[model samples]
Target: MSTDTTTEPEDASLEDLLARVDDLETRLADLEATPDDSQKMVVVATKGTLDMAYPPLILASTAAAFGYDVTVFHTFWGLDILHEERSSALKLSSVGNPNVPVPNAIAALPGMDEVTTRLMRKRIAENDVATVEELVDLSIETGVDLQACQMTIDLLGYDEDDFFDGVTTGVGAASAFREMVEADVQLLV
Candidate 1:
């Protein structure tokens, strides 16, 4: 086959036209795919323990670090992250948390529950891992708002004084639920 020795014309106008079309199509597709402001994230943690305490604060902090506005609602045992004195006293129970290393000697020891709880807290500190308090601090530094359950506190005979300073507010389930519903992701960590 003989090839034609001819050059095709390059049209700058044609390229610009195609680029504009692609951009508009992409924008329309995105708008159709999901609602705007549905990117918000909410994390709720309802447990307070050496093992479970980090989720609410850690998840909220990390999410906020990623440039997403994150809110953490702490309820029930999860409220300990804000506890003034007992926050550090959060302990992992050997009775349920299988990940906790339990030596046979410690298991057989009298008052093993207390002994293990103490050991759990010590190990967490020695490892330099973030405590519930530290994670809560990070969340605060990252602009992650904290909400403690006032109902839980009142039932426990506690008050705002029970929580650490810099906490944004204490609210009930209704307020927390409203925030969660507004968020794209609602999770119980």
Candidate 2:
């Protein structure tokens, strides 16, 4: 004779199951009605050239305007973007940039970077586009968190006072990583 192994379900009545379902539905509806958390955006700015500086600032400012919590983590060359004096004096690299419209040979000339920067500044002025300094100011005013990497600061021999007024200097990479990990949108520029 074969052993009878089939077991009936636990004594869960229809009304009990329906009540549990109703409770779960109520909880789901309450959760659905709750407001969503704010979105977060993080950008890692690794370039300090005049041309390279715009993207992170622009994006950060725009995201802030859209009600996103925005952070721009400046590391390596990007630390210059937060430097009060250097930000304004950032120069466009004439060599190895395809958008410069100059051949690499010609762009490598001694004064070509200065010339390119001058021309670009002129074009920007003519077009009424904001300068790097102006964009940095705007980013600060718009509540974009500007974080300067601590290790880079030590390596480059930069003091905390070297950065702009609103910049958060001496931030470590691990802190930046935490922010990036929690960010809804992350970019490396």
Q: Each model's C-alpha lDDT? A: 0.76, 0.91
Tens digits of per-residue lDDT, candidate 1, 44-162, equal: 88888767877667778777877778888888887777887888777756654455577655565667667777876788779998777778777788888888888888877878876
**lDDT tens digits by residue: candidate 2, 1-189:** 433432223334666788899999999999889966889999999998888899999999999999999999999999999998899889989898898888999999999999999999899999999988888899999999999999999999999999999999868889999998899999999
Which regions of candidate 1 are displaced past 4 Å?
Answer: 1-38, 100-110
What lDDT is reached at residue 166 by model 2? 94
- Backbone clashes under 3 angstroms, per model: 1, 0
RMSD per candidate (Å) reads 8.5, 5.2
Name the lDDT value of residue 124 in candidate 1.
Answer: 76
Question: Whole-model lDDT for model 2 versus the true structure?
Answer: 0.91
